[model samples]
Target: MKFTLVIRQGKTQLIGQLKEIPGVLTQGLTIAEVKENIQDALALYLEDMREDDAEDSNAIIAQEEVEFA
Candidate 1:
């Protein structure tokens, strides 16, 4: 999957983030390193999400709507 990579120049290093996903961010001294870090971060984030989904897959969920005046 392709993600939008946003890069910012920090005080001493380059900061990179996946624009599509919040909290998936990383820093490195060079853009190359930042790109690599972003990929790893995104991978880990997706893995965690998958695990979470698996854990909740068997849950019996219910939804209801409420009206407010």
Candidate 2:
């Protein structure tokens, strides 16, 4: 499954967060590294969501579209 990922670079590391998955985030040493880390984090987060008793596990994930004005 593909999801929108937002990445940011810190002084000594790279960070990433999933736009579709709330509270799912991770950090790594490089952009590529952060991408992989975020992917793993997102998988774990989704698994946790599924394991939990929360409803709407099949809810659709949202994505943001960019537009120039």
lDDT, residue 4, candidate 1: 85
| Tens digits of per-residue lDDT for model 1, 1-69 | 567899999999999988889779999999999989998998899899878877787773763555655
List all candidate RMSDs to the true structure.
8.2, 7.9
lDDT of 1 at 41: 94
lDDT of 2 by residue, 1-69 (tens): 567888887777887888877589999988888888987897798688667734654664753556655
TM-score of each: 0.76, 0.65
Candidate 2 residues lying further than 4 Å off, grouped into runs, are 54-69
Q: Best TM-score goes to which candidate?
A: 1
Count clashes in each candidate, considering only residues at least 3 apart in sequence or on different chains: 0, 0
In candidate 1, how many Å is residue 44 off? 0.3
Question: Cα lDDT for residue 29, model 1?
Answer: 96
The deviation in Å at residue 31 for candidate 2 is 0.7
Q: List the residue pairs that clash in candidate 1.
A: none
Instruction: List residue ranges in candidate 1 displaced over 4 A.
Output: 60-69
User: Could you tell me which 10 consecutive residues in candidate 1 have the lowest summed lDDT?
Assistant: 60-69
